[model samples]
Target: MASSCIGKTWCSSARVGLSLSSCVASVAGKRNRFAALLQREQGGRKVSVSSSVRSQSDPIGGIQEGLVCKPSVVTGVPSELARSRRRAGRTSQYRFIMAQAASADGAAGVDSSATFPTVGFLGLGIMGEAMARNLVKAGYDVTVWNRTASKCASLATEGAKVGLLPRDVTEACDITFAMLADPTGALSVACGEHGAVKGLGPGKGYVDISTVDGVTAMKINEAVKATGGEFLEAPVSGSKKPAEDGTLIFMTAGDKALYERASPALDVMGKARFFLGEVGKGAAMKLVVNMVMGSMMASFSEGLALGDKIGLDANTLLEVISLGAINTPMYTLKGPAMVKGQYTPAFPLKHQQKDLRLALALGEEVVQPLPVAAAANEVYKLARAAGLGDADFSAVLETVKSHSRGSTSNDH
Candidate 1:
């Protein structure tokens, strides 16, 4: 055998054919190629270092930071030395590099050693973090990237690789999922410099789960297709808790092949997923769902306010509604919270307003009359203007209460 090792592999030392590297050391008659690179936890996002020059932590898990790995050439090393190095643990400056692999964790997750399509996640907000972690727990090799790198540190510990740009994730993985804040952010990350479009090519998939308008989704889809990459717009229906529990509802469209290929991953992150046949359809479905949701919340708030003014208890009103024909999970889940004056934002008021605004505009463009949705949009806007934009959508109760007070003062 040739003496030189190639990144932890024994190889011909002649520096020809396929084995040339800057990392090798030998003891006695043995040579091993050592690699020192940071592997992040499952929900992490980007970290690019120049020769790891900016790496703040040591290679070992024990030290929080300050681990520097500089490669040095070594000649003549025995196999026993390699065995000793393995036993030395993470504290050793030089660790043996093994082939990239992942192990399957039954049907739910994958281990880091088994060979599967590497997954990439962009944006590590609450929803993104939760979704990415589910994939990690299912045993898939995931690479993550976020605008705020600090949010990704914990995921790095769970065996995720950090990426520096939207394109980095696209180039590195067969499929990439993005869960950004809004349509603007989604478009920027997908089409801007170092965006997903730059890295996407044939055989790659880009799945965006952001709640954007159909026009926005279609635009992104066109950009991805221009790069010969598949695109799927998969906007979800449930909120934070559902995302965390892997019970979200996925409304997906565009690129049937990509949809089929992403089924395993989608199954891991959602309870049910619908393939709606086209990119804009999925976006439209999400908007319609939210539009109905906003109208229902606005109506619910009005009912509660009216019941209160009639000296009926809010809880009693909720109980009556819960048993009525129109009762829904939204009423069941948010009723008590609304009654108790607690709005912790399962869905923000501002987002609801935005969705309603979009749905109304969509209705207008299609020449469909949506007086109820239009009215609900105004209430949500009123709530947003009342400084409840960050609060839960149900906080529109305050908007209702303010209106009621104004009505009473006018009556006096």
Candidate 2:
């Protein structure tokens, strides 16, 4: 496999905070907030931080467990373009992370820390509510905020404090997480007047789980950091089921220190995680993954349509695919529904289209060709044009049939 560099090299081992505050030397008579962490040369290969940042087996920043081992923040980034992202797959300590508060009988994994920090959640949509509920059920003190006050009510009944504003939630908690529907909402809540950042100060952290472009993530990161708060771009990689079941995968980046502090909360919300170095990598990874998924869903729709055109039962075709190596959870969950012309939203079609669009833009930025993503983008656009934006992304099946055999089967 090809090796990538995160701008450093390690021979034995090392870590440092490197106080950016002092490193802010004036350039052209102006101080710079961007700081570079010192590096030691090791054959000049540039450091490839392990795919998983293996935490040292020591308590980190007053938190117990394997949170101590963390990567030094990648430095030398310009003030205008500073960002980082990271997360990890299954690791030993994470097993403890995913566990719920132990039963009253003193079962295993009981969190007895009086210093466990309270968490604040902004946005209460489909994904947000479930994630916040999982945190609350895991015994972390949780406060929640939503534009629609009624949405917060449901979580309030489940032992979460209903906060009056994003500011209210952030002020009252050590870390605040935002899971808004889109970049606009996420930006508004985090950077707006009386928004979450207004309440954020030193020692506080903000994790944004919303799917947004790298530009938006960095904008929020700068805004948060300007106020002495930390930022982590931790966009998730699952739908409603994964969110509710506490099995979502988190693609986290930025603020390795905050990553250490938030490990327990992250473990509660995700089954697996990867700490991609730097802020935009997490968002980049999600877009790349979703681009493939969107294309696959579009191709799957084509397969179903071709089967129906050739006089095969849609269910039979779906069963055959399931038994084949090409099968996946997307096919298993959306196949039958597509065959029956059901498009109830598991993940909204518009969101899938949005992800594809973002992926294409990222490709353009890096000069990567994304021919397949471009084609898939068109199919999703067709579904949106057919008024299936709010339907499951699998609704592209209907759009596929219309394009393939001129069957106007999307009238539902």
Q: Which ten residues in a row have the lowest lDDT in candidate 2?
A: 74-83
* Cand. 1 Cα-lDDT: 0.70
How do the predictions measure up, each by TM-score? 0.72, 0.74
Tens-place lDDT digits, model 2, residues 1-412: 0012211222112221212222223222123212221121112123333323333322222233332122211111111100111122222222222111111111323332322567899988878888998777645678999999999888898789988989999999888899987889889999898799999998789999999999999999999999999999999898988888777889999998888677667766777677898998889999989999999999998888888888998888888889999999989988887788888776899999999999999999999999999999998998899999999888988888987766556844
The residue-by-residue lDDT of candidate 1 on 1-412, one tens digit each, is 1111222323222221211122222211112212222212111222221322212232212111111111111111111122223333421222212211111111224332222467899999878998998777654678999999998898999878899898998888888999998899999999998898899998788999999999999999999999999999999998889878778889999998778667557756876678999779998999999999999999989998888888998888889888999999999999999888999977788889988988988998899999999999988888888899999889999999889978854585
Model 2, clash count? 21
- Give candidate 2's error at residue 52 in angstroms: 27
